[model samples]
Target: MKREKVKHMSVKGGASLFALRIFVTCLAAAAWWECLFSVFPGMVVSRSWLYGAGLVLAVIIGGAVSCPRRKVAVPAVILAAALLCWRFFYVIQGAAAHLVNAYLAVHQERGFEVRFWEEGSLSAGTLAVGTAVLVCVPLLTILLLVIRWGRGKLVAVLILLLPVLAAILEGAFPSAWATWMLIVTGGCYLTAAGAGGRDMAGPAGAAWAGTAIAAVTLLVLGGVSVLAGRAADVIRLEEDGFYSQTRQAIQTGVVDNLNAVRLRMEGQDEEADDRPEEEEQLPREREEDRAEVAAKEAPSASDEQSETPGDSGAGTLPWDTEADGMTDLASVARFSPDGTAAVDVRLEEAPYGTVYYPLRWGGAYTGQSWEETSGEDGRDSLFLSWPEGLDRLEELCASWPSDTVEEAEKQIDRELTQKAVYDTEPGRTPTGEDFAEYFVFESERGFCVHFATAAVLMYRMMGYPARYVEGYAVPASAFSRQADGTYLAVADGTMGHAWCETFEDGEWTVREHTPASDGSASPGSETQTASDSALRHGQAGDQEKAGPGAMRIAGRAALLLAIVGCVIGAFFLQAAVRRKRRLRVLGGRNRTKAVEAIYGTIYDRSRTMGMKESSPLREETCRRMADMWDSIKEQEMRWLYQLVLESMFNEKRPSAREYRKAMDIYRKTGAEMYSRLRGWQRWKYKYIWCL
Candidate 1:
């Protein structure tokens, strides 16, 4: 009668423990759902179903790995800690970079220049979340350790309440609070479920079952949320008229700019015709013969141009032409050091053509620096409307069989360099002489600017519209390959360069005439061709082209899948190995060890199958197993138990025949219990071992 009462009490306690675990798991799952929603609202868009399913799977896997019965919890805790540290370090580094940039901006006249690193700098909300994670991860680790080492309900409840309290206090911030709540509650539940005590066994199965149900429920809720969000978006777009008006305003502005450009170009042509031919043409023969001696006597044209401009604004544009303080020669004659990273460019959409870098254009040199020439004249001449001097250059370009802007640019570049020579010396040009004319006909050996200026003037003189440009240039050789096949080109102060562009097919295309002095290809030349081709082909077959945001989503999804797969694979593999080792012991020649292995397997299987209360099974092993068994199985279990006891304590070994009989009974009992379980129950039994 006493034994029966004790058994009843044990069963009741087990049921209560199971309920507690289920409650904790649910709380944890809810917290996780809330947190994810807060961090990435867009993740719950059209693909809410997928995101929901993924969330459910993540919860289940996290619960299982952290379950006290598994050995992986320690490693999982370590990994989580490492991830937190990495995030902390990343945030600190970004803040430092921002500070440096801010300081530099304050000192410089141009103010702050935005760089690529600043793009990913943490915002206020993200920083708040990161701080929370830093605090929570360590706290959770300590809680897990406490539960693993010393099990108590008070400690578990307190740990679980931390996140709950946080959630309530910051209830207005649902995502953040929910994330905290989920991480705290889930971590606490896992620690409790895995910590083996009197009622641990019964609750193990219940905890797993509750996790599955909770996952499905959350998935359904996520889908509903997605549908509602979509409906709201539709209503919002329909009600908002600002977007339509803004788009119309943009279109109107573009048309006005185009019209302005056309009127300006026409006025420039009229002005050019009115000016004398003598004023435009240089004294070519005299300049060539006197160039070398003129270098010593003439004042630097650069210095003369720099003197304050007259009211006419003949030497510079009406806009600020103050030199950015960089030497004028630096813009035309510099090269980036090999392997320096300058800029990153990505093509987020398809059907995109070659990339172009805009440099100085619609401007003429003031003998000192390049400046915009659009003053009282309505507009400067664009490439489409060339001056009469470009007739020969136009004929040369027309003779080439190029079908595209890129091909045409390439042909023009080759022809421009064929007649030019590169001069390495700085400060070699004679002052007061026409810089372009001297470089082309007299000097013939200046650097990039000289070559570029000559090319632009030559193209224009031959009736093909061209313009000189100057800015930092990144060559193909300086670019490094990225995993996505885009190239990262680095340019520094030394890479400041000058080149030209010609109008083709209604668009201005880059043309490089600078010789490869360092044996490096020009920017957008042969070196980038392979990478460009790869980008084109890579997009051809992608039916569902994604934007930058979608790509980020896809990358994160892939990472999550990888992590989940590894955890699941590890769990199953560990279980399989342990089972195989037990089987090997059962089939061994050592009769004593074999009998012990068989009895232990049977005992664990009984607890796992929930046939006996987990707590009592530890102390009253024989009695608990006997009461849970039927007549035949109970008798068999008692005999095996006694034989295992004799082998362990009395130094009396079981014979080979006895070991075989014990193995047969253990296998038979497990099979019978497994066959009676429902499909989901069987799955739970196979994956999670409470003992």
Candidate 2:
């Protein structure tokens, strides 16, 4: 009963309503494209926002197929497409170049992790053809929905929500309120239209009513957006250590798999190279046994550790995986610590607590050396033996106090030292492809470098973008009080430190993952000679923008729901306006004209009744229309046409009774036309055709 009450929709506003839906459909698709492209603007090649908006292709194609009231829109669209292709030829070419250049990187303007791909190639002609195809195919797919709007609700919704969802996953939505409003407004109506409410096709007033309701929604959405923007300035959500670790763990696993695939595809024999081809019993070169690091003496990084793992080729030089997935650990393990002070930072205050000062970040670690690999992407993966020793490290970390980061790290200092020794087998160097594994399982010697390297992998396993860091560590104990009540400390290469840091709150923080210095075990992490940490993660809020959290995502979803409500209310209000308009014209002034208009409306609807090959039933005369009407309603159509003609051309206005009689005839004619349509066609004629 409820369905029947609003089921009979008028066909009066079908075309206009459908056109609006089409417009929004294209808009939604375009929005989706823009949002995604924003994440990787380099994908557009030209680095131009205008060029990135690939929806121009869809708009042109859609326009081509639409009626112009004079039927000449197709040629215009074709001309426009041609002009666009010619105008932005460079953009297309750039896109092609981007595709060809394997070792390419996006512009620094994007402020993304400095990304690099391999060098690949393609012919110019092939590129041109590829670009053309790429531009047209998706546009055609989007435009295909114009043929049927009362369907494809899911498809339409997917397009409209693409960017919104992408923004959520990426935590980077468009800043513009209008973009959100457009998507919400279009999505709301598109959802209703897709429900195929053929039984409730919107009347002429639906447009105005929908617009009004949508306007209110727009206002509300604007206010919410503004509040959200302001809230972002002051409110901060620091990462929960547990969740951060979990998320990073998942990400690291995925990165590890991708890296493995990439290595295999690139035919990298790095693993094979890590192992010696012939294990000839070559005489070991005599090397100095390492001494503990002290205020005056610095221990050799290479000579401090020895291999204890039973794995083949266990004793190898430290290797660093380059950003380009290549191993370049060809240098001997003897890198003397630089004695020159390259960087000097003066501190006016005495430091007492555990401090971390991050300098250079290395995203990839070779068995021997750390490399600033990949890009700024936080998804940096450990190159070799990435997670071999992660479980044990995580277990060890679990027993530490959670009261504070520093306290926990202190516990790590004592416990981790107990696990691995600082003494290397006399003159034996620690290095291998499975270096991390060896370090984790063998309980062998580990100096600052070993602890720093292995600790990074351990941190990564615990769900952090653990980056290897190497820089000078100024000793806090070096500070001396002055007469003016100021304290000063001086640092040089003797305080050189190699450690790891964790990504937190948009920047990296030095985490004391390396064991604390205990000179008794030959040397300790940061070395006995090394000072406290130097880099901190105390970044200001304005330094980097924060991504959306769960709460923000929920707010967006709520906004979407509110907009959907507005869309529905708009159509219902439109229905009421349509009724008032019908009553005013049919029963108030202009009786003859009103009756004539009603009959003419019914006559127009009749043209589409039988779904004929020649649409609009363009017969000039009522007799011709009757002749073409093959159904039993032919006589009824003929009578209705005659009545409409008489009313249209009548000289004198009709009386109330006469007008009622004409309306009666008009009502009967509408019923007859309706009856002529059978099954789904009846529903289609009432809802879809008018919709």
Candidate 3:
């Protein structure tokens, strides 16, 4: 009997201390809100005050109903409401809505993209912080639940590893590991929490096993990842150029074999050369007039006089004639009296004047600029030249309707302006022919080869002394006149473009129909950059105007949601705590049912106050109460109102004497008992989810 008395006394003392603690906590909470209000605008506003009042009244009524005569309920309800509202205010204005809106707004601005969190935004930092708080509250609540239930440390560990896990799977591996890791982590937490709920505290030995497994799994996964990464690197290197190198080596071997065969066959070439003269006699004799009436004299080392009038040499460069199948020039042309007679004949053989082969032309070794070097280690010579066939092209141009010629020429000119269409350097084929093959059909957008071939064909048809020139054409910028009036020019691959020189009136004249003089931008022309060209095509946006107004509204809405969520969360928790206390005091049978009724009443009040209370509230209750008060007016119950207001809004709760004085006025206010009871119950249920 004596021990029971001591225990009872201890309980009473503890209850009194609890009341004092609540009082102190109320004061501290109010002060915190006040401080926040000072920093942020509108802390003690009409809307907030109304909300806070409503929430506090609901909690009081719920507490009264749950523990009929317990005076402690009044303060408990008030304090809980205030705390919830405070938390909610910060969250809505600070976090969710604000963040979304800021992001939208920033995106609309030039140079204002959403940066990583570390790179702070001046206007949105506060809102971001608020959002951070919003996210943390739910996470913290979950953590608290985990801790209370004594779950496995997986939840804590995952929270800690969030950034690390995020970093690990950023670029590409997330799909592979993200879901698996999440499942593992969740399973661990659930198992631990379940164990705790069952009152079966997990053994320390189990922790060791978990750790061992985790370590081994991580190590195995890490090793596999490393190996895969290395293998990928190897594959990439092989793909880049290693395979090409092997193919080139095989090609080189084949070419060497061909060269060896040619060397061996060379001895028979002299005989072959001699036989042409004898065997060609019949055809030459029959077509004497046609063969003898050559279009141009034979080409010689002497520039001006290589054309030997009647001799015509019966020799030609492979590309000069209508493309012929004869790789052996002298043998093929020998049958024709002056080689000119073989033009139509050769056309039946190899018809393509130019052929293309893929090759690399620019890199570190070759220099970034195509004009810098011919090629590194002679590798650039392997590139495929875009086929520019001149013979076939001339045939087309010759047959072109006069009315369409100018327009066709203009279109071709545009093509020539492109870098891909023009050839600054010739790429040789496997046959070792340095000249790019040209055909009339392919050379419509022809560079120098096209122009030269066209000139040759036209000159032939018009009857003039014209032979294809294979030498490079240097730009005028590279030329300098010598004392003898001969011009010398720097001869580099870039300056080695093709063009034609026709022998007109005993002098060579240049003829080129390609577009504007290449890609070189004169120092005086700064506006000719690719950007400027795109601008002319109307692709650039205006940067001077403000971004769309929708972004601003979004930002504001984000801020508002965060505030509401946080506030509502706080209120729910307050109601939950009150219900728990009542259940403990009055016994679960009566208390639980009463608390439920109280919560329902509070919920209805919340709705009337226009405060949406989602299930599982994560907002502050006090702010909600304050917001509710603004929508009502009742002077008779002013004292109770003042007491609740002082408890929530003051830096500290009112003294007991002050509260008693206010209570006296409250009881005499003539408030209908049913209405007061309903209002109090409504406040409780409204925020019950916060628990």
lDDT of each: 0.45, 0.45, 0.32
Best by TM-score: 2
Q: TM-scores, in order shown?
A: 0.26, 0.30, 0.21
Off by over 4 Å in 2: 1-23, 38-41, 44-60, 68-144, 154-189, 192-691
Candidate 1 per-residue lDDT over residues 1-691, each given as its tens digit: 5346435544564455444544554455445445534432322222243234333433433444446555675576567657756767775454445434433432221222445335245765444344334433444344433333334546555655553453344321334345545645555465444434321133344335544543443444344444443233222222123432453344356643564477587886575457454222211112222221122122223322211111121122111224542125323332222222122223333211223333235445443455543222212364434334434445655677655555555565665554444544423456555555555545455566667666665555445566665444433223322334343332332344556666544444456677655422233332111121212112211212554345444444554555565565466556545544654566566889888766676677667656645553244777677665442356677788778777888989787578667765664555445545787667655555512
lDDT (tens digit, per residue) of candidate 2 on 1-691: 4223223433334555555555554555455545545444344333233333444555455545543431477666556556866886665555555643321332222223555543235444444344544553354445344333344556655655665665554433443543665566664455335322332233434443444445565566566566554434222222333433454455456644565686688887575246332211111111231210222132112222221111111112123324432323333232333334222233444333222333345666555555554344444454222534345556755665545434545555555554554432212244544555455565345455667676776655445566666544544433333334443333334444556665555544555555444322211222121222332322223222343454445445555655665665565456545544554465557877786666555556646654333432244545545554333245555555555556656665676776665565554445446545677765454334532
The alpha-carbon deviation from the true structure for residue 498 of candidate 3, after best TM-score superposition, in angstroms, is: 28
lDDT of 3 at 255: 44
Error of 3 at 274 (Å): 41
| 417: Cα error in model 3, Å | 34
Residue-by-residue lDDT tens digits, candidate 3, 60-92: 443332343546764664466458648667444
State the weakest 10-residue window (summed lDDT) of model 1.
309-318
Count of clashing residue pairs in every prediction: 18, 20, 95
